[model samples]
Target: MDVCTLGDLIDVVGSPALRLHTASAGTGSPVTEVLLYDAHAPLPHAPGALLLAVGVRAAEAGPLVRAAAEAGMTGVVVRGTDGPAAEAEAHGVALLTVGEDTAWHHVHLMLAAAVDARSAQGAGLGDLFALADAIAAATGGATAVEDPRQRILAYSTVPGQPVDEDRRQGILGLQVPGSVDNSEQVRQVFAAPAPVRLPPLTAADLPRLACAVRAGGEPLGSIWVVDTGTLAPDAEQTLAQGVSTAALLLLRRRAAQELTRHQNADLLRRLLDGAADAATAAHRLGWNAVRVAAFALDSAAGVPDAERTSLRLLDLVRLQCDARYGRHACVLLDGVVYALLPAPEASGGAGGPEARTTADRRHRQLAEDIVGRAGPSLRVPVRAALGAVVSCRDGVTASRADADAVLRLLDDALPVAAVDEIRPRVTLLRLADVMRERGELRAGAWQRVLDADAEYGTEYARTLTAWFGTGCDVASAARQLSVHPNTCRYRLKQIGAQLGIDLDDADERLVLWLQLRVLAEPDAPA
Candidate 1:
């Protein structure tokens, strides 16, 4: 497996978030964890751990750096421009610094993500940058490997190799620069049987030679190198040969990614189902949130290619949630996508009405954004429902239940809602579930009304529903049913007479309404 070194952490976090103050003996050490330094706590020996000296002053960081080095830590990150460089070098520990304005939590998250990403992608794939460097050496040009989406996976950093503005931007963003248009070139590269040369798209771009990497006739990605016209005589052959190796590496990385995804999904499933101890599962998954919220997403009804669309929506939701909440987990179960989002500390800690409200708003907004963004690409409407924020681990199941309830109650008119936003509907649905399970109100006046309509084709049940729905206003019911008021009144009288019930009795009307609601529920024994 690849080791995520202190240098990798700095590269991932970039400037402002973290900057190297002192490069010492352990600067290149593998970072296994990120820990916050506490003066009052016991100094635990954490080998290869990067310590964040949160609140430690520049002048006070000398001892922290010495302590970290003694504890086998990779480095100590302090807030300020200067740290004890001499002490760090003497102690053989690296000293890093972050801007005072940068939150320690953010830095911690970035470091964690960087370390996790390296561990996740390193299995059996070797080092992609090393491969890029070898290819660049063979081709005599700076090289970059990009996935099918044009995301830069790795690039050659061989010294003295010429690079253009596009390469620099692509490396910085980990994606192709948006200023250059290469759709046609990309198409040709993928379709070409062998290496193809592409003209520079802009004045700042150097000409490139690219070859599609394929395995089992499936395009995995492509490799590109600057064409400085100083290529080795066999540069084309060398790049073409490298394509086979790149394909294998990509295939391995993909397998590793899928395995990780499956493992995460299983853990999330267990958490949502309450099948595992919440705290244990959260710890195993490296989740540190004290509270979490659940979200349910599904495509709207009547969407063609529903299975494909659902999978796409699932990917979209997972991507969006990961981008927003770095520690989130999402899974698709039974055609519905569910996500468990950890509440950020800024939203307030695990309890209180204010915190809950803030978390709810954030979750609902995320859902709305997902739905809106999914529409055009999905070619059909999508809906999302959010559950109330609750304590993490054990409370996840309840939150998931709330999300499921809200999703079931959602309609085209209200594609997104929280449990509390539709509390009445959710309560009624819960009651309907109980009534159905108990077989109550399943074979009484409501059954007879349905039977009457089925047998005689009478509009008695429909008229009664319209009347009740319109608050017993005959004129409103008539308009709703698109019939005359006198006709609606006649149907109501027929319904009451047939059922042997008084239409004016408050108790009777209440029972009848409840039965209607229970029967209206989806799959409620027809």
Candidate 2:
């Protein structure tokens, strides 16, 4: 159903006596229904309805205006006096007044006819391209339908005039360039409900006529006709019809996109959780790469509309990923948005040291691209963590765990991390998690050494840490601890004697080193 605005009503039945009290800045409020009322009659709660006030008194105007606002009416049209302009403005409602001598029947009939005419406009539009074609043919210009973000959704097949740089770039790239995005004319077009006529930026430029495609005062996107010298009355009429048609098409497009997003999210969740056949899901999604690299985006709490902001960020990330790597998926899980990209040819058909190095570089590049592209557009600060690349066929769960582990490092200071890039710290953190699960690790000789140090204030744990950290170099270990090399040797002997272990054994040294690291920060990694 089409909506009738107070502006339309004014155009229909308004005389010199009728004046607009409140100025609706953007597209005016849309009214789909109307009600007739008297000052003393029952207050009707008809949201989105225009209320017609008949035989209203000056003193009763304030209360009636308040009543209409509270009843969720779009606006109130009354005769006799100013109709409490202050009260209407305070309640964010539109106020209009008719000539005192105008008949009540005439007022009602004019409003009804205008509304009926509104309902008849923008009817029988087949698709977005059809609407775009109609607008372009009527105005004799090139037409493109773009979202609020200026991303092109559709364009007319017929270019009615010679294309300019903006139109050509927008159609080819499917988005407005940053240079054009910052234009004052672009801002005005979004802010105005009626069509905006923008003169050329320079003598060599083309003029543009634009209008917002909106529903219920909420803008869906905009429709633009480029190189139109000046719109004729018929062209203006066509533009109005095209705006309404564009709104309906955008609404349908949004509905279909939301449905597809929900379905993809579900399938992705199952694949990440290892609860469904990942191969099947991957095939369905047209992902054929051999490795899967996951990117986890940390949620920014303590911000207004955090969920909505995060979802928008997720959409931006998905767009960037799709542009770079065609087959990628995204999902919001546990307050964080995760992206899974099919890493192409990371190992180069040889899963060796070179392959690992190649995979690391590729994953790092992917992570950087996402952060660079989506980071600036985000309202709230967000941290990004990229996981190690794993085999696509059998490592979905492992890849997610890697991503989650990387995300655990996010803090006020450390905002981004990659598991492969920080392998040593990642290793310690992973081992820390294992240490908590296996209590039997506590009964090892290294634990005894740590317990003895706690009991006798010994430096065994510190000595072992320095020694292993220096790769078993006694002098370097001593230098790191600010102690003599002989003292380091003496402590090592005491550690082996007290813990009843062999310092010469490689296995014993490895166990002692791991034990010291585990107890170094015994608390589980976040």
Candidate 3:
């Protein structure tokens, strides 16, 4: 197996300041050794070794950091709350910093414990595959590990390999597809805290034995094994032991995930809103000169519990983004979930028109993909919108505004739309709100049109609105009202006569169109 990663050490320490530099390749890069550095002695050089340095001069620090990278060191951990971050980031090596009170010996001990825990599977600290292997070895059948959300974390097959379609798909996709996952049998597996004996759904399927891997009162995940003629005498006891191991691993994973989520949420809002300095934001958010796009999620049409649904769906989006885009940030804001996604690395890093275009295309495709994959689990359809891509800092604010504009244009109307694609509607929507606030929509020509309709029992206002909306096409206006073209023309002429406005004047048409948009009911057709 590969050595544990720098990410593993970070999770063990659980500190916000120990961040991977933006230019570092990835947190998953393997760490094969851990060592300490001394300024008086020659720099300790070892491939994939993480070196911790203390009390080095600023002049010596820069050269030592550069030499560490050249020596093939995986990363360098330094003391102090702050130091030459830019120099370290430029070298593209993981630069970690621990608090003043933390001792080098203490860090070494922590790293050693974390590595050992990760290496031991049956002991219940880490290594999902080892845990699965142990279960399969004891039960004499194929084994799999799954979370309560039905995500398949790991699996191991029987020695002879008796695999079925369901098991194959679960391994291939890393989770059972919603069609197979949303079943009464799976529901029952999570419903109880004890082990379950499940009967196969069809002749093609096989019976299974499952046990929940839980810590505290909260259910973490489950372990399952195929049931053959009979189990070994100690198979059930081994399965129980595996459950304890899996539960501990899951608890650690969940804690790390929650800490990451909270940190990302805080940094996302601050960086986008320009509430943090560029250097601090870059260190925390872990991106620089990167194209950033925003997206928002809300409930579909006719959903009574829109608030609750949006939050739930938002969580699914966050999980998917975390799984797919390692350098992304997500937050829930004002009943909507907002995300700041970095453009793919394949796109050039500079913030130019070509990069923006590529990022916009990617965001649109990502929006479609998430809706297609996770939409079914949501129970109700969701409305989503993508924004333009911009560089970090003030540009993020503009990107957020673009996403919010697209979202406002969504409401219960559209499935998904990009900001640039709906600029006209977005402009009109904003204008309508401004007009309403200024009392322009409540009085003047629109009010007179409404009053005229009420007094004379004429449908002139509706006809005029349709005519303007359809760009003066009498046939289209007639179709909108389900009336004859001649009737549409007649109503238009009556509206002109009553309002004393020339139908041919472009200015008059523009004013009437604006009024109609502002007066349109919240649920009215666009």
Best candidate, lDDT: 1
- Cα RMSD for candidate 2? 17.7
Q: What is the lDDT of residue 518 in candidate 1?
A: 65
Regions more than 4 Å wrong, model 3? 1-52, 60-71, 74-126, 161-205, 259-329, 333-336, 340-385, 388-398, 407-421, 427-526
lDDT of 3 at 152: 88
Ranking of all predicted structures according to TM-score, beginning with the best and ending with the worst:
2, 1, 3
All candidates' lDDT scores? 0.78, 0.70, 0.69
**lDDT tens digits, residue span 1-526, model 2:** 3455555455333346355667443125776766778646688788877777866764467887888889988888878665687888888888877777878777777676556555443332337777788788788788888888888877887733666787778888999766653467778988887887788775656888788889998889888887656555666667878998788778866664454455556667767787655554554455544333444444544666667776777777777766676456688776677777665444555566676667567656766666666556664556677765665556777877777777777665766677676677777778877887888875577767767888999888788888998999999999999999999999988876767789799998888778777656444353
How good is model 2 by TM-score?
0.62
Tens-digit per-residue lDDT, 137-237, candidate 1: 98899999998989899899889889889899899999986543687888899999999988889887789999999998998999999998798989999
lDDT of 3 by residue, 1-526 (tens): 3256676556444555354443365776667777777768887668777877766643356776788888888777776656556777778667777666777788877665555544332233347777898889888778999888778887885577465677888889888656663367777877867777787666777777788887777788889887764766777778888899888777766655565566567667665666544454544455654333433444334667767777786777787777767556777777667777775333365666686677667777777776766567766655677766555644667767777777766754466788778887777777766776887455667677777878988887788888887888999999999999999988888777878867788887788767766665443323
In model 1, pairs of residues that clash are none
Worst 10 residues of 2 by lDDT: 117-126
State model 2's lDDT: 0.70
Compare candidates 2 and 3 on TM-score and give the better one.
Answer: 2
Q: How many residue pairs clash in each candidate?
A: 0, 0, 0
Question: Clashes in model 3: which pairs?
Answer: none
